[model samples]
Target: MSRYSLIRSMFRPARTTPHRCRRDIIMPFPVGRMELIVYAAVVTGLIFAAYHTTLMDYLAYQRDYIAFTTAWPSKPADFKFDMNVFLEHKRNLMEYANLEKSLMQNGTALHELKVAKLYKPLFTDIPKILLDKWVPDIERFEGVEEFLNATNFNGTIAEEFFYLEAPFFQFEHHRMAIMFPTEIKGLLMTIKIGDCYFWSTCHHTELELRDGDMHVLDVLETEDGQWNISRVYYVPAHELLKVRF
Candidate 1:
């Protein structure tokens, strides 16, 4: 009870209390099992969708790769490669086998003297001028209207034009934007060499001219010397080169 004793006791350190563990108190939200499951499923679905979309894109590109390597050994897949309509058609020609047969056998050439001639008006002035000057077959453009109407283009030049013009992709697989515009330059167009139309990517595909105008060993024969129609016989502009023993 002395003043000195009281001061010494006050100066002494107080006894340390034991540390208590705080329980992890989760906020008492009344979440049912179904709610938790639904939330988890949504998250999982989002992840799956993202992954699936990427996988699909990759698969589509690979499909193009296989087609390129198998069909066009001559044309390498670079930034500057374009496919002709024949090659494009060949991608799914089997589905349209009957139609192709009719087109090839019954309907004359997709581009005849008459079809190319009469169809000149639909074009802009520049194209009209170019077609008028370059396209020798005046009457050939005449029949395209009937042909397209009979076919799927509904009398529009959409289908027939796609056939004649050098290909730049027709929204198959995905979109035209998928391919760089520059990459389209190296496109081997379908050359109207003779009675047959040929897809020609010889610049990149390394197609060698054999005889007069035949590149793939000159298998096709036509009086006009222009390969006009893409037949099953015509080699794809891009294919694997033969290795000599």
Candidate 2:
């Protein structure tokens, strides 16, 4: 070739190659049917595993919800109040009272009454100081034992004086209403009791019981899968208007 022609060829753009047809291309290792099947199975397994994990989490949340809502007795009928448990509770109270009498007679230190054994086991786990309110009394107890003892004493006194009073202390008439899962951190409940009286040579007189006092119970699930009340907030009947169920 001439020197001038070679220089012109170098300066000009090279001719572009024609595009190859799609059928002309070939993979180094073509995918076999078995390989495709394996790939599909792996993808399906991953999807199922993810779905199963999500489903398990949802089921767990539902279980926790159910446990929390049904933790307390809904009504008097729902409460498994065994007469044996009640009799044992009453006996404990009577013993504690007798012990108190003995302590007074012996001139012992009454400030610290060690009657922890008398407390009902069912309520001993409740905190001594609950939601800024002290259980049994405003005065602080020496320890958990003393606090529980005092709590049992006060509880028994309240039951005898208010609940199991003269003429009409029917267990059937006692009812409890609960409003659960409020926007706030606790549940609200009310206890209703019936009152009636008999008159001499006249018809029976029925007295309407006052509106029940509502209580807000702060419940917590323990590590061992048991539910417990951490605190109780007393909401007066009139204040129920402020609460959202």
Per-model TM values vs. the true structure: 0.24, 0.23
Listed per candidate, the RMSD to the true structure in angstroms reads 21.4, 19.9
Candidate 2: what lDDT? Answer: 0.34
Candidate lDDT values, in order: 0.36, 0.34
lDDT of 1 by residue, 1-245 (tens): 99999999999999987643322245333357997798778889999999999999999999987876566434422332244544465345443434433553464443232233323333231122222122111122233334334333332224323333322222445422112223222232322333432333322212221211112112334464322222111111111011100
201: Cα error in model 2, Å? 56
Clashes of 2: 0
For 1-245, candidate 2 gives per-residue lDDT tens digits of 99999999999998988665432465433267997788778889999999999999999988987875575445322222355555565566445445544654574332222222112232222222211221121111123233224334223322332211222121234532222222212111222111111111121222221111112222222233322212112211222222212
Highest-lDDT candidate: 1
Structural RMSD, model 2: 19.9
